[model samples]
Target: MDIDRRTLLGATAMPFVPSVLSAAVSADDWGSIAREYDVTREIIQLEHGNWGMMPRPVLQAYRAMIERVNRDTSYYARRGMAGDLEGVRAQVADAMGVAIEEIVLTRNATEAMKALILQYNRLQSGDAVLYADLDYDSMQASMQALATTRGVRVMKMALPEPATRQNLLDAYRMAFDADPGIRMVLLTHVSHRTGLVLPVAEIATMARQRGIDAIVDAAHSVGQLDFRLPELRADFIGMNLHKWIGAPLGVGALYIRKDRIDAIDPDPAEDPARTDIDARVHTGTPDYAAQLTVPAALAFQAAIGGSRREARLKQLRDRWVRPLRDMPQVQILTPDDPAMYGAITSFRLRGRTSHDENVELARTLLERHGIFTVHRDGLASGSCVRVTPALATQESELDRLVEAIRELAS
Candidate 1:
């Protein structure tokens, strides 16, 4: 197989033409690649939004980092740790086209998000925090924690589906206006549930105009989606490197506006002026081996070529979607526009108790066909099956997914 691990890692050119993504002939093409990688083409594993499986080179590099660290733990930590972290931060920031000062390494998206949310030192007892109903549950839970424990008001509103960019901006605009007490907003760059891209920068503009802070949860956005932090225009941003970029776990990032860093009180009494973004939020010692692998993932992406991988994934998503779109029983919850979507999508079968049935259906698909997907509810309050495609996912597997769901629904 020319599609060996080395080949995947060594692909260095980016002939990325998004319009090249057509529904036809794609599944078979992707099928061969999946088989070459020993990834099953018979069943779809459309679940990369939660945890992206690592590329072969990334996996190898992760093991190499561990072995290297095991040889001289403290020596590596003290001798080159500072320089290495700086180098990694610079690499990551460059990947996102941001200044190195804007990037800080963190354990995961949750820590990054929490630290950003807590940074709004102006948040008072009567102040309100607004977030979309389609926001990640963990973020919602964080807001709940803030309301109950921090004496702030929390507003979680439903986001309109099949929504346009303006539709999203309207929701946030209304939410902020309805309550002058609203001091902050937590926006999702891409919803983990429906994979609908949000209007982050526009919302950020609205927030700043009103003297409020906005934090964007880019957990599922970083590698899977093409973007820069400043474009989101949020005061703060948090993302996970493990899922999309294939970094080893214990890896994510916090991006804060340089001006906002001063207002943020570092956890465990660290100074924000240090320029070590890691020092600002991640107070505890992280797994160094895992952190070290981040650069490897970044390099691997560069090698396999970002633009090519991104286009291929987009093509896969389009292929998975086309078969189900016109079916009467199928309700596609993800946006029809590529601009409003990423490497993920969601849909549902028309039925009663959609949530329970969707979960059971997902379980059956996995059990019967080796297909794996996550079923979601609560955000927009309907049962929907979430589909995330990784670089390893192939078209034949998606065909099975389309057919299997159709058969089950019928």
Candidate 2:
């Protein structure tokens, strides 16, 4: 099973080469596209928000990389690894419509974000940092760490339930106006808990006008939604490839706007000359095979097309959620606005707020109905079970989820 780097580069470069099964599927058939993944049929998986399952092509590429690296060992590491990584980074940049110099590959979004959060040097004493409760828990802890280690004030607010575009924008407006000392706001492009897509470009523009900086946590949005870097208008962004891009696990990226790179002080441990976007965050040797497979992942995603994948994911979400819309006992957390959501959504059963209650609901869904989902906490309203449908999710599986929710809620 050993594959050399040369073979991998040559094979993935020809993006037209479809996986064996997919080669027979016509352009109009999405079911054939769904067959690319070796998904299990024993249980209906609706919790794809946590981690994406790689398609057969990407997985094969990963295996090939593993074999190549394992066989070549340090010889490959010393010579070919750097160029391969740069190729992967270039693929990431191309996929996002950004320049290669502005992006760097990291182990995951959490690592990328913490690097920016910890290295940012612009915050002064008495300056406040703001983030919503919906931001990633690790990122919130990093913000809190800044409060203790740097002596800056930390502020957090809950996004409005049933969020609308204007209300979401206005909330940030008032928060900035109310606290003139607020120097930075951490905006989650899509809430993992509720799947609410905030108006990031509007919020970023407003923050810029107010002399505030924003670091976007776009861990869930980039691959799920079709957008470019300029659309967000944020100088600093941390995103994950593993979640939506179908990249192998342990691969993600960080973007520091070319002009704004200096705002994040260079890593003190690195050489002063290496002071560009790549120098801002340092994670010791990552899973190189996983990183090398990014190009193949990006290529696979491109073959499917971003808009088509996004549309399919949303269609799956709607298939499950639309049926339960009128269920009195079910409280759908995501708003109805198309602009506000993608594949992720959450539903709370009436009177289910406690940790145990939410966990039980998720457990029952799996144990009784063969549908898998996750329970999420940290909302102002209450706890909920989050359902995230991947592109490969079948209509029958979604219908099964709808039936399960209907029975459980009723």
Candidate 3:
């Protein structure tokens, strides 16, 4: 006799069972995992792309570390903190399939990417650097500063709104072929504006063949996607642990390939002779508690695995987006292609693409329907409201968002 899948899972849920997760799990099973997150009950949160709320286990670990640091203070600072930091770094490096020598911790993606951008030593006075409009604003500012101080040219492009694989590749190809003076390109692994996942390895290879380097801004992609350093085929990258990794806030990292570490200038705050990746970052008086809790966050993510989490987040995004795609006056920014996106998506009404209009729409969603989203600017096409769902978000919560958009769009 054959039994149902849920029944089979229930039968195996015995004492001392570990949290083994599978992407094919039933809705009830997904909800069971969702319960482990301590999200707010007052609002239907659909803006988790900014920062992820830590799961209960990670939060517990964070609180415990805080207490321990408070108890010992200077002693831990002088002695125990070094060993704990090394252990966390080893776990993070192991998880990403990278060497510990190549990674360094920072406050967040802004700090990490800024360090990578401002410290790159390849540009000449007239050489050009390329970046897209959808790149993070802070990183863009750092690139602009390079142009002013170092006298390098800055070129910007806009991604196609309804982007396709071939078109996306073609755009970058044309850009590189058109300009030999462009020596460095900044790429976003997954766009924060519309959740469009660029083909990083392909673009990076294109840049390399032309003697150009690529710096990846992976703020929203690391824990949300399954690929790692070697897979991206880039020499430098900046990542966020607080966003999708569900670690405590104020944690991020940067990666410089072992062979290419010397190409970037060291942080002046540190000894100039130090060429290690850590020398690129100089976060004074670090958040020792959060740094110590990084291992627990890594452990929690390891239990569920990156592939499973990626599948689950994509599933949730599709569920809400599929029903609303055909609705008139609503334009979905993220394409339906699974390979092109993860959890984050954005939408705009037929003519509501202006900054004020999009902001008002987001306000209406929150005030009228109790669904929360954020208005994002800097899309070359126009502004839109970004909707992001966390791993802990429920189907019902997304359904409410769908219904509210239906009502608003009508």
Candidate 4:
């Protein structure tokens, strides 16, 4: 029997049965898996980095939870919701390989990261914090804000354009050596601008040796990459469930090592005396339905298996990227190294680095080819258009994207 969206959604409750596939599933098997997602037919969607779409089963579960929450209303919120949310939190913690006491739920990664950045208590006057161009824009702003709030100096550097795992590590090591006053550093596990995966664990370990705390922004890495949260070796980390986890929008998580909880100040509204992980971010009244549907999303992801999912995503990425790697007119920002990239990759036309040029390039792909992509700025080298393939994206659609790039480059 062929598995399809209807078949999955027909289940009375969300199914937790794992559908473990071999390292590389066959095309027909992938096609059957793709059928589990009901994507729009209007445009070829290669822009899933913003957020992930819930598979049909997860969506059905989300709708059911929404209705249930709406019907039960305050009675449920005031009575059993707390306990239910704790169960959800436990599931998330277990998946992240952390204790429940070390993780807390938040609206999104930005909220969790903002709380970590703003509430971090170790900085003093003249202390310096380091971040690179690849960091998220909002996070960069928050790091810069420390200059005013904490009387710390904010230092920004640009990662090497053609980055390598060793050079990337050396860059941070050298930066730390140059500036001993650096008290904290912000690390983006995967670059949103160019889809470059940093050597986060190595750099975090380097920072720790120098007595500098590292705060990792893992918004794009958690579910997309097959790694445990502890692997990054950071004391604090923030991640999004909505992006790669395929959870409903408005779900994210914050992780703080139990021993380092005191490093982060409690939320202003939270009582200082009660400074547990939960007190770190006080996001009052989140989307309860979305939070409740997390288990369904996890079950859906688990069924696919993390290693298999990562392989599939990277396979999709390489389909287009490998073909264009040597094209004279195209500049692929990410290197060929497997460790430095994942599903997301960005490319630039040799001479088109301006913001408007890249924007127009993305526009041409959408308007002319019926393909959707996004233009990202903030890389020191220049602007580029990012192509991100979701689990549901067809190989034929990526082939179309490759053809479009070839024609455009010509």
Candidate 5:
């Protein structure tokens, strides 16, 4: 009698578990060792780096919070609920290695980035603010809106893919070099389109050297990458916990280096030093329970082990690269360099028009095949599907994605 593969593999797995992990790794075994959270790959969910699906505990906590709030709305508010919210922010601040005094809880990275960008000392008529064309559209739109209303200049740089990190570093240098008058620089922690992980420390160093304020839109970096807030040294940094952190959708964090806090003007109102982290993020009263659940998400990250989580995501990524890296028409936009990519990777359909074709492709895959992905329509590149995986993604599941793309491309 031969033992089944699943049974044999399960007997040899480790007992350690992360509350918020999507998958577990054990020795050479490829299956998710942890109890299944039931996120099937039947349709192929390779875009987790875009929006991290919550683990069971997080989903349960979220649903319970909503139910409790609805049961006794008044009792929950104007009570000890506010303290719980603060605790969540403090834990997040500590995890990111930033002081709570300099942190602000927000709905997403875009909100935090916009709040900081709006606070530039002053944007003179001829003074310009620089950002990459790859920056998220929302952040880019905020700059454009300011440009139109404030008579400021907007300088955009279009970065190429399959390029070296120095190529990116040089692009920023070129953009700023062309116009020494560029007062502020907006950058992405990970290009949502190219999946390029930039040398943020180097970029921040250049900004300080040039006397420019660097505000980074880190919608994709936080949980997917090991980020220490204190070391980044950017004037302003915003992160979305929901993307790779596996938190509820409403939660995100902004870390302002304590010394740099004074440099930023806190939106329409000035928040006293004692105010909660929401000083700039408070858009009227929000769902306190929604905010309170963020720490649980962080706990999940801690349990999985940060570096190990990164390694697992990388393992899943390799499954795709092995098959598609050699494809001729498939332009792997993501840097093959491990230092430059995490859970997210992008590719352009060479000899193809991706814009409308990709938009339709997105809907068709999701509706017909149940595969969900980003259309990449927002970027200058017309359209292509981006695949990203969380720790929970299995090799067999990832193979499904490579097979589909190869078939489509072939």
Candidate 6:
């Protein structure tokens, strides 16, 4: 139960041996790499945006850790778990390219984001806060709560449909210019509803210039995209290891820059004067086994370089999207710009935008085509089905999706 660096590294290093981590990875190489995962034969899973399935090596490591934790019980929890957890924290911090003191593990991104949103001390009476329709539902509710809790006005905006990097930037600039009272803005790095990748750093910079604070929701971007924490240029961020990093479902991290830790109040249970980032979140009795297995997940992702994994996922997305783009009845939610999207994309029938219509659309895809997808709401345009492809997803599955859409549209 006491995990050291050597033991953690040893558990994950040997199992993954991807043939190619380069741009020109061959089809056979991708096939071999796909074999590392154990996906279900019951359906073609295209809803990986919910959470990632642990690769075989990471799954085995998790099972072993679960067994060890059960066997040791409180003996390990009381004696050596703290030290082991610090090692895991260090690993997560290193993977994120941040100092160990600046980040703390949480049960999930929602918990981390709620803590940051509720505890932020910068808001004053009559000040305004901004969020978009595409932000996660829970985060939107949390931002709405600020109106009652902090006496601030809540502002919501809609992103452009055929989004471009320049137009997106212009939208934020216009919003900030229109509302000088806006004190904080919520930015989602990649939209869960429609895989639109925001220019977070630029947007954050614009907010700062207007004396506003930006809280970033990076739940879908951290492992799905190849970038470091610093590149975001934000002092506050909440990200998930379970979504794209391939960790167990209960693991995530909260980040507060070293100088800006004071801007967020500590959890009610902790002393307000305490300066450490750990005081910001208080999750009683977290999943120790899940947390301890984070290194194995990081190792698994490292084996297949981040850039290569990103390219593979986008390739899978483009396969289905390109063929359907010309269809008059199909409406692809995400744009074709390479920098504006990742593995996730949502779409709806041209005239069908109701919740029930999208629900039926998702049902037909599953029942008729044997491909699994989920419907998402809250976009200004309307409800649509979200399709997310994992690293293990085969090109054949995507081709099947394309065929299914074509037939349905006809």
The Cα error of candidate 2 at residue 334, in Å, is 0.5
Better of 2 and 5 by TM-score: 2
The Cα RMSD in angstroms, rounded to one decimal, for candidate 1 relative to the true structure is: 5.1
Residue pairs with colliding backbones in model 6 are none
Q: Estimated TM-score per prediction? A: 0.88, 0.95, 0.94, 0.95, 0.87, 0.95
Best candidate according to TM-score: 2
Candidate 1 on 239-356: residue-level lDDT in tens?
A: 9999888888779999887777765567656765654455568547787777777776786566545566667778888887888888888778887777788788888876533678
- Clash pairs for candidate 1: none
Error of 3 at 240 (Å): 0.4
Give the clash count for model 2. Answer: 0
Candidate 5 ranges with C-alpha deviation above 4 Å = 1-30, 33-36, 40-42, 269-277, 360-370
Give the lowest summed-lDDT range of ten residues in model 6.
Answer: 15-24
- Writing each residue's lDDT as its tens digit, candidate 5 over 1-410 gives 12232321222112224422334433433354323344774676667765778766666656666766676687766775666666676788788887778777888787788777775555678788888777888888887776876678888877765568898788788877889888888888888876778888888888778878888888888877876776677868988988777878877777777666656555666554633335555566666556766766676667766687777777777788768999886767777788888878876678455587777766765776666777785565556777777766767777767776776677
Question: Taking the tens digit of each residue's C-alpha lDDT, what string does model 2 give over 1-410?
Answer: 23344668553343434644345343546777778788888898888998899988789888888888898888988987787678778878888888999999888999889988877889988999999989989999999999877789999998887789999998999999999999999999989998999999999999999999999999999899889877899999999999999888998899998989988877777775766888887788899889888887887787777787778888888998888898889889888888899999998898778878999999999999999999999888878999998877889999998888888887
The better-scoring model by lDDT among 2 and 5 is 2
In model 6, what lDDT does residue 23 have? 23
In angstroms, how far off is 347's CA in candidate 6?
A: 0.8
- Candidate 1: where are CA atoms >4 Å away? 1-43, 269-276
- Please give the CA lDDT of all the candidate structures: 0.75, 0.86, 0.85, 0.89, 0.71, 0.89
Ten-residue stretch with the least lDDT total in model 4 = 18-27
lDDT of 6 by residue, 80-190 (tens): 878878888888888899999999999999999999999999999999999999999999999999999999999999998778899999999999999999999999999
Candidate 5 residue pairs in backbone clash: 22-392, 23-392, 46-388
